[model samples]
Target: MQPLDKSVYGPFQLYYDHALEMWCKDPANAGKQMSLHSVPQMVSYAFQKAFTPAKILPGFKSTGIYPMDRNIFPDHKFMPTYSADRPAPIPNRDEPASDSDSERRHTATTSPAPSKLDTFTSLKEIRPFPKAPARTEGPKKRKAVMSAILTSTPEKLSSQTVTISAAGPSKPKKLHYDADDDEGSQQCSGKTFGWNK
Candidate 1:
């Protein structure tokens, strides 16, 4: 066939070459795919194909399988089982009485010694130890002494008096003239010249 185009089929060519190489060297992988259980057989086939007595790398040899020892698989060892059946310990139930009970008993026994009447009698009997005598005379005695002094003085009269006299009667004087004088002339003169004229 004509040469394939390098620009279009370059990556496909490389993949096909690698698959052919794997198929040729691995006898256990008789075809393109193999199962997980056949990995040891495949590794054995690859070692024999890729390595020889003359072509072996330094410090390397064909051991016929991967990891060379069976202990490398963790599932090869044994594991112990666990249980959740054991129960927790329980607390104790019995205990003794406390000191508060004794204190309450003592208080209840000593609460009734003093009554109300006993307290009142004790207060009334608490007077002063010694007493003093009483006096008899006071302000009334002084008042009696003053009254006796005022009544003992004597009574005296005054010498001055006011007198009134009765009024006397007024008397008329008797007039006497010369017995020989002319009475008619005196009358006529008095009547005519003095009174009538």
Candidate 2:
């Protein structure tokens, strides 16, 4: 059944909106702009015209509300409640129970509790993992080895002590090439290779 307001049934409203939109796009009303009052009337008329009693009558009959048939519900629905015509068979408390049922009931009552392994052990009771071994000084890198090699050979290097400035390494001078002067280039190229050459 349709709700009082379309917005109250959020999921149904989506399908309803789509159906309304398709109905509005008919060739008869190609470029029509619907007024607020006309829109609701159009929706109601469309729903009434589309969903006739023939389509809806089957739903009421299937639910068994119109004919008032109690048999439509499964056996489970009548399990809790009993009819007065047939009184429920009372168990004979005086008679001795069968061996199988007695054994089953005895085992059910005396079932073993959960094993110690299955039960939860607290973190506080469990022993903590052994502490990680202490970290020692690692071997020197390649740069350190190269520096040590250069400094160790005192005889190879000049005795003159080099002074390091706080300004860091000096920038190299840029060479200006003059195409007109071939002689200057030859001199410069010779010096680059070695003064002896």
TM-score of each: 0.14, 0.24
lDDT of 1 by residue, 78-191 (tens): 433346445546776577546896788789898866755744455447875566678756655443332223333331111111111223343665544333243332333224
Pairs that clash in candidate 1: none
- Please tell me which predicted candidate would have the highest lDDT against the true structure: 2
RMSD of each candidate? Answer: 55.1, 18.1
Clashes of each: 0, 0
Model 2: residues with Cα > 4 Å off, grouped in runs: 1-19, 23-34, 75-197
| 1-197 per-residue lDDT for model 2 (tens digits) | 32223223343355467656776787776787766766776566556554556545555565565666657768776664544457668877987899998999999889977767977878756976678899997986655333334455573353223333445688997764333343333334234322222
| Pairs of residues at least 3 apart in sequence or in different chains that clash in candidate 2 | none
lDDT of 2 at 109: 83
lDDT of 1: 0.44
Error in Å for residue 11 of model 2: 13
